[model samples]
Target: MVVATRELPASGYALEVDGRFKAEFATRDGARAGAEELKKRFPMLQVRIYDALTRAREDVQLPRA
Candidate 1:
């Protein structure tokens, strides 16, 4: 039997909601865009973008009403 393991890129970005990973993107802009859309649909959920290279998390602020 053979198994395959997926490798993630060093510059990849990850979208996190409420401390849980929701999606992954090849670019930071893509991840940010995804977070924004999710924030728009669910105003109560906490959205963030995580950088795999720096091992940091950036909080996404909601737009002003």
Candidate 2:
């Protein structure tokens, strides 16, 4: 599983996982908050964050449960 954020000019950011839209955030902080939520929801999977603007992708580091 992977989570990503796409920037929206008017709305802020859009969160997605596996090519599906999961949520919309009003700011970068909100998107990061969404990422944390995703980590909590899927601890066993390899979650990641991708920045559409930078074209960079990295795996999400989940805290030990």
Candidate 3:
């Protein structure tokens, strides 16, 4: 039996909700915008942006009104 393997893009941004990957974007700004929108809609849920290349995660926090 033969199996095929899939590889992730070398550089891209991903949005994670509650420690699970929700979506991926081509640009960092896009990912940030998505995270912000999700955070606004669900204030109790944890949102973060992950960098595929750097393997880094940044937490998203809402601004105080």
Candidate 4:
């Protein structure tokens, strides 16, 4: 099976993975709060909150063979 992924924009506040919106906060502190909110809304898939401002930027793509 091939899974598709997307590289979210720098200013993107949320991500839609497989039709589901993965909420991402603007700051780490905010992300922490968003994490809790996301968990309450969606109890599936692991929610990862990142520091969009300080964290190193990287291109995210689907796994390739």
Clashes of 1: 0
lDDT of model 3 at position 30: 85
The clash count of every prediction, one per candidate, is 0, 0, 0, 0
Which candidate has the highest TM-score of all? Answer: 3
TM values, all candidates? 0.79, 0.51, 0.82, 0.40
Which whole-number lDDT from 0 to 100 does residue 39 have in model 4?
54
Clashing pairs in 4: none
lDDT of each residue in 29-55, candidate 4, tens digit only: 554555555456665645554344554
The candidate with the higher TM-score, 3 or 4, is 3
Decide which is better by lDDT, 3 or 4. Answer: 3
Stronger candidate by TM-score (1 vs 4): 1
In candidate 2, residue 52 scores what lDDT?
53
TM-score, ranked from best to worst: 3, 1, 2, 4
Instruction: Report the CA-based lDDT of candidate 4 relative to the real structure.
Output: 0.45
Question: Which 10-residue span in candidate 3 carries the lowest summed lDDT?
Answer: 1-10
User: In candidate 2, where is summed lDDT lowest over 10 consecutive residues?
Assistant: 1-10
The list of candidate 1 runs beyond 4 A from truth reads: 1-11
State the weakest 10-residue window (summed lDDT) of model 1.
1-10
**What local distance difference test score does each model get?**
0.75, 0.55, 0.77, 0.45
Instruction: Put down candidate 3 lDDT per residue, 1-65, tens digits, no spaces.
Output: 01111333356878777877777788898888888988899999999877998999899999999
- State how far residue 33 of model 4 sits from its true place (Å): 1.0
